[model samples]
Target: MNWRNFLAPYAQVVEELKVKLKGMRSQFEYESSHSPIEFVTARVKPVSSIKEKMKRKNIHMDNIEELQDIAGVRVVCQFVDDIYDIVDRLKSRNDFEVIEERDYINHKKESGYRSYHLIISYPVETIHGERKIIAEIQIRTLAMNFWATNEHSLNYKYEGRMPEKVRTRLKRAAEAAFKLDEEMAKVKDEIQEAQRIFKTNKESDD
Candidate 1:
């Protein structure tokens, strides 16, 4: 199987989703309002990782569409409220259909992972024709992103055989991250105002 050929469409989905999500942020900025999306990042899963996932899940290459995160996009926000705001916006969009949503923020995973996941069926126009592919959009606060990033690195390091003590420490860190997010939420209005003023000055200077 040609990995490059197989992954081209997933790559396109990531690129397109990044542009559209960034456009949402730009629109909010243009209107001089708080954009729920602070920043967006996206990627197509690497072939090696995909192969590992297939092996772990007993998935076949022919049924790759079952892997919802082949094309992944992350929307990071300043506040927890911003996450739900962005979710609503994504749900209302016409370009892609949201097939499912998992609200991990309210019901976090046992690993203390907290992110709102949206499974979207994205349509991409390829040279052959239009292809609809399953993709994942993850929305989370900056605090959550930081914790999750480190947790991911640790998971990679441990190779899914993390010691009980290390897992306990991670769970404690996750709670601390949530507390930070909660504290930030209390001052969210002030932060947004300061950012708005800074943006205005930057635009004037430009």
Candidate 2:
């Protein structure tokens, strides 16, 4: 099968789904006033031939559609807990069907990385008909996403296997990222409380 031929049909569906998911950001924000919610971005990435090679080895490449992982959406939240809350709300939606889920936050990888991933099937009505495409949604704190971006680049540069020393360094960096997230959460709480106190004092003075 010529996989490239399939891209066009799916690309349109991907764009439509992106718009729908982007619209949800405002909804999430209105519900979670303590923090900002934004659609990180969305894209449809073609699966590299190297990925195909890895799939041949029991790694399980589910479908040609599944290969385009960036097809759907990425929701970036201010806090780690917000990521979970957003996922809970998304899972409850009738329009989405959860196909697969991986919670890397609680079960950190050996590399000490963390993020939550969801592969969901949602129906998109095209001129042809209603097609259910599987889109992968990744929810992660801003810090986690930054660390992942750096780690991905390093992995690509090292051809997927970094030297032992570099690997150790990356693991340490991941730990630092985890700590950064915790500290950020604490700071956010302090700032919120301070703002509340200021508001109360201003109202009293008035």
Candidate 3:
């Protein structure tokens, strides 16, 4: 297939998924005082990236279906509990079919990466017909996202082979990020109350 033909369905999946996932965040905010989702972002994998990943994974060039993350969505939340809440909500939804799940939160990767990942197949309407594409959804806390983003940047700079000292520091930073999430969970109510009071006082002043 031509590049445009190959990527068209995945592109549509990314756009629709972003809207659907953001709607989930808005729904939570409307239903409760504290919304779990902090923010959501998405992307369709570039052709260069897809080729690099296929080569890295030793997948045959023709095995495009083996590439699960052609479309990727990231949902960042404020609390650890919120991660699971968002996953539960995704599982309950019918718009997409959840095919697999990886709980990196409970079992962190050796590199200290942590997040809950879901592989979903979503059907989108096209001129020809409905097309189903595999997409990956990653959910993590804000602190986790911060640490992961920095680590990813550093990894890119190091070209996937960081020195031992830098690796050790990254591991420690990951632990600190998780610890911060733990502490935030303990005082979530107080934090919410403070936010409410701040909003109320600001409204009164206005």
Candidate 4:
């Protein structure tokens, strides 16, 4: 199948999901004074990158469906607990069907990566009618997002063959980031209350 034929639908999925998820965050901030999500980011993998990943993972060209992250959304939160809360809300939503979940927070990778991943199949309407595609949603705290973002950048620089020095530093950095999240969790209630007050005053000024 020509991947170009898939691009428009994939873009539709990314844009629609990004809006819907961000809207959920806005609603929660307004109604509960506590939003589990700090921010949302998304992407539809480039055709070239997808093809490269398929080759690297030993996935056949015909089995592109096996790669779940072609359409990806990432939800960043302030505290680790917030990650699961957002995931729970996602699971309860009807717009998409949750295919699987991976809790790397409780079970970190060998590289000390931590996040909660959800694989979902979402239906999108097109001229050809309805089509469903698997999308991956990765949820993590801001600290974890920071670490992952940097690691990804460095990995690309090394072409996946990271030097031992950088690898060791990344491991240390991951530990430090998680520690920061834990520390923030200890005072989350206080921080949230301050945030609500600031937002309320700012709105009043407006």
Off by over 4 Å in 1: 204-206
Per-residue lDDT value at 13 in model 1: 94
Per-candidate Cα lDDT values, in order, are 0.93, 0.74, 0.91, 0.92
Ranking by TM-score: 4, 1, 3, 2
Superposed by TM-score, candidate 3 places the C-alpha of residue 155 at a distance from the truth, in angstroms, of 1.5
Ranking by lDDT: 1, 4, 3, 2
lDDT of 2 by residue, 95-170 (tens): 8698889899999999878999998887877667887777788899888888888998998798777999989998
Per-residue CA lDDT of model 3 for 34-126, tens digit only, reads: 888889999988898898888889989689889999899999998999999989989999899999999998999988999999999999899
- Provide the TM-score for each candidate, comma-separated: 0.96, 0.79, 0.94, 0.97
TM-score (C-alpha) between model 4 and the true structure: 0.97
> RMSD per prediction, one decimal?
1.2, 4.5, 1.5, 1.0
> Given candidate 2, what's the lDDT at residue 82?
82
Clashes of 3: 0
The regions of model 3 sitting more than 4 angstroms off are 200-206
Model 4, residue 158: distance off in Å is: 0.6
Range of the 10 consecutive residues with the lowest summed lDDT in candidate 4: 1-10
What are the per-residue Cα lDDT tens digits for candidate 1 across 107-167? 9999999999999999999999999999999999999999999999999999989999999
Candidate 1: deviation at residue 121, Å?
0.4
